[model samples]
Target chain A: MNVFVVGVGLIGGSFALDLKELNSNVIIHGIDINESHLQEAMELGVIDQKSSYENLSLADVVVISIPVNAANEVVPRVLDAVHEDAVVIDTGSTKAPLCELLVNHPKRRNFLAAHPIAGTEFSGPSAAHVGLYAGKTNIICEVEKTAFKLQERALKIFSDIGMRIRYMDPKSHDRHIAYVSHLSHISSFMLGKTVIEKERNERDIFDMAGSGFESTVRLAKSSPAMWTPIFQQNKENVLETLDEYISNLLLFKSYLEKDDFQAIFSAMESTNKIKEILNGIVVKPI
Target chain B: MNVFVVGVGLIGGSFALDLKELNSNVIIHGIDINESHLQEAMELGVIDQKSSYENLSLADVVVISIPVNAANEVVPRVLDAVHEDAVVIDTGSTKAPLCELLVNHPKRRNFLAAHPIAGTEFSGPSAAHVGLYAGKTNIICEVEKTAFKLQERALKIFSDIGMRIRYMDPKSHDRHIAYVSHLSHISSFMLGKTVIEKERNERDIFDMAGSGFESTVRLAKSSPAMWTPIFQQNKENVLETLDEYISNLLLFKSYLEKDDFQAIFSAMESTNKIKEILNGIVVKPI
Candidate 1:
């Protein structure tokens, strides 16, 4: 099996590692605009060879894991090059735009739009490791658009890697992800900004910060090159979520200003239901 | 040595566990308004006995781990009731108001205003565990006001439990914590609230939520009874941090509205420096 991974970074590199571990016959090919990432991934044994889109014709599986904006352009080109028998999947955060872009393509059946709900705040090939997708959820948007056999092929690989799959329409995928994924990233980034801005005055604030602060601000360390395009591609839904979040913050602030301890307490108490919802996620042990 | 813990919940119970482990001669006496908490703590061995203020005069150490508002009322009372040799330390989130309330007390020198920058989102006696304070910071405000011998006794226990200590004026502690600690809680609670409110329309939004969302919203699960008072006591600084955080969010929203991807990218890139800042704090492995 020829597994070709485009833009080999954290997501792509991890996928390559896992695939090779699953099958001794699998030969992994790495392609990235950043030549250093390909070299590093190869050094780390994440891939067997350095290759390009020109060589994608040899691929039995092509996985595109790049920034959402780049995925929009590169995915179609890769789809154009790959054989009809090959399964081409792009693992980007947003779905609706890319699904729409490829809807009219003749080889639309060869492509699968997937968002693996997994990552740390780190990036690049060095940050990649095996089992990254273990027990994690993967949202497959417009699954019906992909060919039946190709879907089966992708599903086989996904199952082998320990990922749980869910099917959803592209529009709903983007809207719901805006709340669960994108909004959290924005809130975390702004938190890092607000605290860094204050560190100019309080140099010791970091000393006072505990693991809780670290957990809350973890997303602030994500790659901007990857996330900026996501926030841009899903602008409408992201904006809606942001407005709602800001409104909630303002209401909490108003409660504080008025010294309405009861209201503030009630707001947090209601949100405490998130404890059970979060339990649905498989939290890896420390 | 007799150790009395008032409000035998997460912090207080954890302290009792670590203190008991430090010496076989140590006896932990639990005190709480809630009879069930005291019973539970005794059953869990988080406390060896159940006692009260009437028995506090026999205490060599008294750790107050309740809400800030309750701390303001109970800390001075404990100070008045304890022997001159007993070290009375109140571990609340806010420090300024508590320190101010005790500055003129007849037993002021026996009281220490210390905030342990440690805890999980869960509370109550069951959440208590040994080594909870290991490798975490404990902020000691107005340490100079504490009796030298009493301070030594408290420092001895802190060192035994592997806690790092830093001295800060109570006013500065409250102000800095508003940015790093209080603001993060409010942001997390709001993020949880925003996604939850949307869940009313899209019930499966949580299915798309991943560990990142879990990390960012973890603090939202904190007890309302605990945090409401922190916000109340530190209202001025919390409001200041809120204004700055909301402004940052609004500015990021404006960039999105105008499709200014460069600004968005740069904003996140600058904040990525928090990566280094966060690294300075020891991250426990997962």
Candidate 2:
């Protein structure tokens, strides 16, 4: 099987590597506008060949693994070039906008919209690894819209990469991911900003940042280029989630200011239930 | 040397274990208000003997490792009972209030107000482990108030346990800790609260939580009893930090709502500097 992957950065690069590792017969071609990333992907042996979009017509599979904004434009273009039998898939973070944009495409039946609930704060081709998708959930939106054979092909590929599949509407995917994924990125970035702005002393931040701070702020290191469009595409939902998040913080702060020890204690006590929720998720490093 | 540890939970239990691991001649006496924790501490052999308040005077050191509110009351009382040659220390998160309460104590010279920046999210004797303080910073505040001999004794113990020491005033310690530690707890607790309230389904939370959410929200599992007083005691600093944090989030939310991709992108781009600061701290599992 021949797979042509556009935007060979973290997710794309990892998918390329995993495909090669699992199926020796699979030949992977890398494509990226970032020349250095393409070179890095090839040099790192993430892909079998470096190719351009002009040759995407020959691919058995076409994966759009770019930023959400780029995916919005590029996925349709790739579909226009690929053969009728070729399967199309995307690993974009926000689903609704992309799904809405591609809803009426002539080859929409060949495209599968997916979000693998897996990632690290790190980016770039070098950050990619072979087992990135293993034991993680992959949400497929508008699955019924895709032709059965193409959907099966995508599912088989995901299964080979060791992912559990769950189906949902694009709208629902966007809403849930706002809370689960998007809100976390904003929370972490703002936390990093808060500490950096308030604690001007770099030495103090270094000396005092325990593992809790490290974990809490780790996502602040994510690529702004990749995330900017995700936040933009899922803007409304992300904003609502952020409002609720800020409100929660303000309420807790008031409890602290008023010396309402009982309220503060009970609030923290209630959140401890997250332990059980966390224990059930599969956590892996990037 | 004999060490009597009041409240042999996470912090105190670990200290006892480390002392025994380093010195065979060291005898540890365990004390806790919770009978189960005391029994578990004894079963784990964290101490040589389980003792009551009457035993406080027999020790060469009396370490108060209770909740912040309890430490304020208990440390003063423990100091009254300990031997003249003994060194007393408290490992509560907040120091300003405790230091103020004990500032004019007749035996203040025997009390070294120290805050060891070592802990996990989980609490109780079951969570204790050896070497929890290894290479971690131990902040000693108001050291000048401690008797020279007592300070010397405490430094030797900390050194033997493999800790790096830093000194600061209790007021400075509380302020910095509010940003680095207390605010993290509040952010995490609220992250958990907001997600739980929005999702309304624990199963969805378990399915969707990635490592980013888990890491950022890990501190939400911390013992409320341990954190409530820290917030109450350092209310001013916590409130200010919380206000700034909420403002940052709200600004980012507005950018998202307006689809201001550039503003959101730049905001996250700037906050990514936390990567460099967090590089200095060691992250240990709780």
Candidate 3:
């Protein structure tokens, strides 16, 4: 099997490594506009060779893992280059825009829209690892649009990487991810901004940041290059989640102002249910 | 040496274990308003014996690890019970109100306002473990007020627990923590609350919560009993931090609404500097 990976950065690079581990016959090809990333991926042995869109037809599988904005333009071109029996899939964070672009395409069945709910805050080819997707959730959107054999092959690849799969429509995928994933990045980025603006002394922040602060602010370290496009593509749902989040913060602030310790206590106690929900998530041990 | 811990919960219980690991001659006595916690500490071998406020005079060192509201009242009484040669230190998050309480006390020299900047979301004696303070920061406030001899004793204990110490005024301690610690907790709690309120399906939350969401919301699982008093005592600083955080969120929301992807990109890129600051934090590996 031949796999051609677009945007050979963290997700794509990691997919290359995991795929090679799953099948001895698998040959991975790297494709990235950034020449350095492609070179780094090859040096790191993440790919067996470098390939371009012109030769994408030779790939048994082509995975799109670029920033969502570029992905909007690139997914169609990759689909056009692939053969009828070949499968093309995306690991982008937002699905609706890309799904819309391919809705009426001639080779739409060759494409599968997937968002593997996995990643670290770090990026680049250097950040890729073999087990990055282990025990993580992989959301497949508009699965019924894909051909049956291609779906089976895609499922085999996801399973080989140790992912649990769920199916949802593109609209629902955008809404849910806006809450569960995209909003988290915004909250964390804003948190970092607020702290950096207020606490000018970086030494003070270093001395006082406990594990809780580190964990809460960890996502702020994520690459802006990858995330900005995701927020742009899913703006409506992201805005809705932000509205609810800001309102919740304001209500909690009012409780603080009123010195309503009871309300504050009850509010936090209610959110403690998140612990139970999080425990059920199959995230790999960090 | 005999150490009497006023609250045999997370902080106090963990401190007792670390202290015993440091000194073979050290004897720990558990004290808590809640009988189950006291009993649990004894069962967990976290303390040599169980004691009470009535027996506080027997302690050579009294560590007040209770909630801030309770600490303000309990510290004076514990100071009164102990001999002049003894030391009384607290591991509370807020320092200003407690420092104010002891400003004119007869035994002020024996009380050290210390906030060990370490903890996890879970609480109780069951959550206590040795090395919880290893490589973490311990903030000592109003150090000049502590008698020279007692200060040495308190420093020795903190050092024994593998902590790096920093001295600051109580006002500064509260203000710094309001940004680094208290605000993170509030953000996480509200994030959890907003998601839970919007996503009615628990299964969906379980399915979609990636490691980023888990990290951002981890502090929402913290005990309300422990945090409510910390926020209440540091209400002014907490409110100030909340105001800035909400303003930042509102600005980001406006950018999202306007579809200003460039501004959003720059904001996140700027905050990515937090990754450097966090890298300097010496968190002990779990």
Candidate 4:
């Protein structure tokens, strides 16, 4: 398979590496607006060679792994350029706007709006790894709109990369992901800001931070370029979840202020069910 | 050296294991209000045997490692019961209240208020490990009140357990800890609640959650019995920090609501300084 991956950062780079590993005959062509990332991805062996957008005509599969805002704009262009037989799929955090943009395209059946539910706080080609997608979910939104053959090929690629598949509409995918992924990023970024502003001593924070702090603040390290448009695209769901999250924090604060240990304890105990839920998934080693 | 440990749960049980590991001649006598924990501690080799408070007379060191409320209530009693030569130390999250309780005691000089900056979400004797304290800080508050000779013995035990020492006033420790440690627990617990409430399907959360979500919500699994009293004891500081945290979240939410891409990007970008702060801490391998 000759795979063309645009914006060869963490997700695209990792996909390129996996493609190379899975089949020696597979050739990965990399593309990125950032020249340094393209250089790094090539130097890191993430792709066979750099390719022009015009060359999408020769590709078997084309992955648009740019930021959500860029994906909505760029994926349609890639769809116009790609061969009729080429499958054009996007790996973006938000799916609705991108899905809506490509819904009326002539090659709409060639496009699959996908979100590979995997990544670390780290980014760029340097942060890519072969097994980044393993044991994680890959949500394919509005799969029925994709051509049957393209959908089958996309499923095979995901399965080969060790991801479980879930099907949902673009609207549900956007809403669910905003709660599960986008809100976590905002919560983490805000948490990081609070601690940094309140405690200026980086050394004190370094010494005192335990695993709990690391996990809560991990998403703070995510790229602003990648996340900003995600929040924008999924603004409604993000706002709703943020309201509930703040309300929960306020209620917890009131309980603490009143020295209401029973309320505090019960609330925490109820949330402790997360332990059972988390145990069912494969979390990265702490 | 003989050590008598009261409340043989997570911290005390781990201390016992480390003490026995450091010296073949060291014997750890356990005391717990929970008979099951005491039995499990002995069975798990965390302690040599169950012992009474009267055993404080025979111990060279007495470690009060119970819940924060209980620690404040019990440390003074143990100080009264211990031999004049025994060093009485309480490991609790909040120090000002515990220090206040011990200030007028007859053996006030023998009582040290310490908080070992180490713990896992797991509780009870079975959670104890021989190296749990290795490379962690053991913050001693109101240490000036401890006699030089008792301090010497206490220092040796902490050193044997492989903990670095830091000294602070009780009030200062409580204030700083409210920002660094207590706030993290609240953030994690509330995040868990917010997600669990909004996303009703536990299985979907389990399937979709990545390492970032796991880290942010990890502390939610902590024992409410242990955390509730700490929040109560340090209510003012915890509430103040929580208010700041919620305010920060609200500000970020406002940015998202307005679709202010640049502001959202810059806000998160500024918080990325945590990368430098968190990069230094060695997260214990799971």
In terms of lDDT, which candidate is strongest? 1
Tens digit of lDDT per residue, candidate 3, span A1-286? 9999998888999999999988899999999999999999999999999889999989899998999999989999999889999999999999999999889999999999999988779888999899999888899999999999999999999988988899999999999889999999999999999999987755665688898889999999999999999998999999999999999999999998999999999999999999888888847633
Better of 3 and 4 by TM-score: 3
Q: What is the C-alpha lDDT profile of model 1 across B1-286, one tens digit per residue?
A: 9999999998999999998888999999999999999999989999999999999999999999998898888988898899889999999999999888877899999998898889779899999998899888999999999899999999999989888899999999999989889999999999999999988666666878998999999999999999999999999999999999999999999999999999999999999988888888864421
- What lDDT tens digits, residue by residue, belong to model 2 across residues B201-233? 536645766778888898988988888878888
How big is the RMSD of model 1? 1.6
Q: TM-score of model 1, chain A?
A: 0.98
Q: Model 4: residues >4 Å from true position, as ranges?
A: A201-206, A283-286, B201-205, B283-286
The root-mean-square deviation over C-alpha atoms between each candidate and the true structure, in angstroms, is: 1.6, 2.0, 1.5, 2.0
TM-score of the B chain in each candidate versus the native B chain? 0.98, 0.97, 0.97, 0.96
Q: What Cα-based lDDT does every candidate model obtain?
A: 0.92, 0.86, 0.91, 0.86
Q: Per-residue CA lDDT of candidate 4, range A174-211, in tens?
A: 88777777888888888888888888853564566666
- Against the native complex, each candidate's DockQ, computed on alpha carbons, is 0.85, 0.76, 0.87, 0.75
Q: lDDT (0-100) at residue B230 of candidate 2?
A: 80
Residue A195 accuracy (lDDT) in model 3: 94
Q: Which model scores highest in DockQ?
A: 3
Per-residue lDDT over A1-286 for candidate 2, one digit per residue giving the tens place of the 0 to 100 score: 9999898877888899999988899999998998999899989999889999899888988888888998988999988998999998998998998888988999998899998887789888999898888888889999999889999898998988888888888998898888988898888888889988988754664587677777788899999999998888887888788889988887887777677889988988888888888887755432
Q: List residue ranges in candidate 3 displaced over 4 A.
A: A284-286, B284-286
